[model samples]
Target: MKITTPRWALEAAGAIGAEMAGTIAATGVRVVGDTALLSAVPEAVEKVPAAPRIAPEVAAQALYGALAAVASAPVRHSAPAKARTVHQTSSKELVRVLGHRCLKRLRRR
Candidate 1:
C-alpha cells in the first residue's frame, strides 16, 4: 500500500495554514483579551485574528508536514479491484483543474 496526496494544491494550503498558526496569537492576542488558545467558536474564527503569518522555516516545515500527510493518508482500496467504476486517464486530466497557470508551469517541468 502506498500513500498519496490529493494534489499539489491541497498540500500547499495545509502548509499555509500551519505557517499562519504561529502568529495567530496563538498564545494570546488582542480581542478575546489573550485567551492563549482559540476556542474554535465559529464566530471567533470568522471575526477576529484575521489570520496570521508564520516564520518562513515554519512555513516550509508546515508544507512538509502537509506533504507527509498526503503521503500517509488512509486510502480505502476495494476488494480485488473488481466491479468498480474505473476509467483510463491521461496526464492532462491530472492538471486540468489546476488552472491554466499551474498547468502551464507544470508543462515546463
Candidate 2:
C-alpha cells in the first residue's frame, strides 16, 4: 500500500534545503512509500572543519591557568533551602490544558 506525506513536513524540508546551500541536491523533500528522504551531495561532507591543534607550551599554559582559577574560586558548603513548594503534574493536565485552549479557539470561531 502507498502512503502520502504531510505537506507541512515537506514545506519545512524545502525551507531547510534553501538554507543548506550546496549540501542539498534537490529543492524539496522526496517521499517514497512511507519514508521521507533528503538527498545530500558528497562534496558537502568534505566541507567540514578539520581537528584543531595547539603548541605544547600553549597547551601547558592553558591547563595551568585553568587549574589556578579553579583553585582560587571559593566553594559553597551546601545549597540554599527551597523557597517555594513544588507541585507535580502529569500528561493528563497537559491534555486538559490543550483541550481547553482548543475548545476556546473553536468557541471563538
Candidate 3:
C-alpha cells in the first residue's frame, strides 16, 4: 500500500494493461485485483465512450477505499455442529445400545 511514488499518482507498479481493463467508468463500485475490470465498469457508464479522461487523485482514493472495503469484509464460515462425532464403543456397548439380535446379525458376516 505504501508505494515509493507520491500518493497523488496511485499507479500500481505491477499493474499492466490494467488501464484497458477499465473499459467503463464504474461509480459506487468495488472489485478485487484479479477481476477488477468487472466492477470498474461504472454503473450506467458508456462501455466505449470518447477519449479517456484522467482520474483525479480524489477519485482514485475513493476507488481504493471502496476496493479495500470489499476485500476486507468479514468472511462467513460454517458454524460448528454439536454431537458431530460418532459414538464409538465396545461391541458390548454397541449391542446394548443397538439390540443383541442386530449385533448377532452383524457378527455372522
Candidate 3 regions with alpha-carbon error over 4 angstroms: 1-55, 77-109
Instruction: For residues 16-55, write the lDDT of model 1, one tens digit per residue.
Output: 6555555675656555443323332222122343344777
Give the range of the ten consecutive residues with the poorest summed lDDT in model 3: 38-47
TM-score of each: 0.23, 0.24, 0.20
Question: Residue 5 deviation, candidate 3, in Å?
Answer: 39
Candidate scoring better on lDDT of 2 and 3: 2
Residue 86 lDDT in candidate 1: 40
lDDT scores in order: 0.47, 0.48, 0.43
Q: How close is candidate 3 to the true structure, as a TM-score?
A: 0.20
lDDT of 3 by residue, 1-109 (tens): 2224443333342243355455333443554455454323223323454553656887877755554444444332233335232343344433343444443454587
Q: Compared with the true structure, what per-residue lDDT tens digits does model 2 show for residues 1-109?
A: 2354565666667566555643443556653442223422222122355454878889977855554454444433233326322233344444444555554564589
Q: List the residue pairs that clash in candidate 1.
A: 27-36
The lDDT of model 1 is 0.47
Per-residue error (Å), model 1, residue 45: 30
Per-candidate alpha-carbon RMSD to the true structure = 19.8, 22.3, 25.8
Model 1 residue 42 CA deviation in Å = 38
Off by over 4 Å in 1: 1-52, 79-109
